[model samples]
Target: MGYKLSRRQFGQLVLAGTVVSGFSYLTNKALAQTPNLNIVGIGSTSIPTDPTAIPEVKTTESYSTHQSSVTTDIPPVGLELVLRSFTTGSTQVIADNGTPLLEPNEILSGFTSLRDGTLVVAITPLITSRRKATPNRLTFLGASSAKTLIVSGLNENQQLGSLLGTNDGRLIGLVGSKNGVPPITLVDINLKTGAISPLSQITIPKDKRVSNLAECPDGKFYTSLLGFHGETSLVQLGSNQEKPIVLAQLKVDGQEWNNGLQNLVCSGTGQLLAFGAMRYQTPNAVYSIDKKSGNMTRLENFDVTQIALVPG
Candidate 1:
């Protein structure tokens, strides 16, 4: 039971100060810097799939609500949907054509993009209200969908980590706990149906967590790690050997990237694109990490809060 924001309502939200924090300003700055880059927004006006779908609006009190919202810039048509998450717990699905749309819920966790151009979003419900606790639900959204699908099975205890779309067309999720107990890791989800198949947990090094996941052209996948000291590393996943192999190390401002890694996406080639800022007010950069050598090349810099690859 959400309402689509008209252009006037959008302005009111911005001027009246009801708009989420950090989102409107950052998104506008990002678009201004990348005038040629395409962006789009995606979200639902109604929760058609969740039977327990209740209309709950919790913005000021929600820790996960994304402070950022995208600009209304128009992009070329026929591009894939790119999803962006904000620290405020909001998630947005923008079209390659550069139109931004909003979802009612703040996706405190991360999201993933599929090869087919669909998006998988893990909705973070409001913490204070049981009527709005939307933890375990996943949303499948695309351009040509007859309707959006929202499926629930995720638990609050399952701290949802990286969401990756595998080459085999299966979507994989890394489930871990902050306290580090119940070592059950890795869940393979049925995209069509919100079914979960639990897999054996692999040992991730202590003091480090997965920052980003990206797949290569050869069908292998890569992951970026964030250490306790705010450093980042590239690693290869899924081989005959169970352990992950460290590939490259990345740094920002001549130091270990301490600002934090927000999202990682494949650049449509074999390389991986890492997006994050070292610290607040620091210019954000998109780094291209060579899959073979683990070398990171700075591609561009702007105020971009989130980024993704749209199908050409």
Candidate 2:
């Protein structure tokens, strides 16, 4: 059977420096001066246990911060979710009245925020134990409450990908194979029922995979396609366009970025931001992308897997 960590026990693990060490808080000088930009990210720490079994929670401990009294209730078997906020030169966990807005035994698959500042997250089971089955869920975390709804329409083999909230009040998501293959279809997610409706099928080269998705203020959808050998391309997607257009190959300075870029978020002011994953001994960093040129400017150095712009 699976085990759940109490709020206090979770705090002890974090206080022991086991949970937060995987994430780095290094901020670039350019981002330190930007007081107006605020970003929220979802990060994970993997605790290696028996891959075929879930571990039992042993101890209980508590953690406190000046901002809020922190308590965590996630299981300690596979991936522990961390919800973080990034500002000028610091990163901190987001809490609500002594409780964190997180779920247990789940991995963050996709993230997005609505125009009214409502945050939506897509999660799937960690699947640490072979004997137990865990259902996929969608959580709507708002100012006063958090509601998790069971995802019904996805097949057992299908997996949820990046999520985007459009200007017209629709929630869009990418649904694709669990192994991250091609034929990633665009789907509309019902915020009320967690039902998925097919929008359009996205076609990409077999050599590449879609890593992240974003929608600009102008209503155009964009996605990052990562190649097998560290090559990355930014492509534009639309129903009106005959085919996807390659905007630019992502590069920093004059060279292609070998470290892959994941989580893509378009800020309210029209700035495209992404978290660059660690690769080939290079550290993780946050960058702002030039939509037209596909050039990236380093904003900060932080190891975050997924990022969403904090709605103002």
Best candidate according to TM-score: 2
Question: Against the unseen true structure, what C-alpha lDDT does each candidate score?
Answer: 0.48, 0.60
Cα-lDDT of candidate 1: 0.48
* Sliding window of 10 residues with minimal summed lDDT for model 2: 60-69
Model 1 reaches what TM-score against the true structure? 0.60
Q: 1-312, model 2: which lDDT tens digit per residue?
A: 212223443333331112221222225453443334555555554443446544333221111111121133344433343433342233333221233333354556787777765667777654333334367777775655568787878875566868887777888887766656666777888888888887754443334467677877777677887666667888876454257788898888878866456578775556677776535544467788887888888776666556666444
Candidate 2, which segments miss by more than 4 Å at Cα? 1-35, 46-105, 126-129, 201-208, 281-283
Q: Give residue 258's lDDT in candidate 2 (0 to 100).
A: 60
Q: For candidate 1, write residues 1-312 as lDDT tens digits.
A: 211233332232221101121221113332233222322222222222345544433221111223333222112112222223332345443322223233333333446656664556554433333234443556554543322334445565455546777666777776654232334356777777766676544334334466556676687667777555656687777554467778767764455556446567664445566766665435566665555555555655534334444333
Off by over 4 Å in 1: 1-105, 129-132, 146-153, 178-184, 200-207, 291-295, 302-305
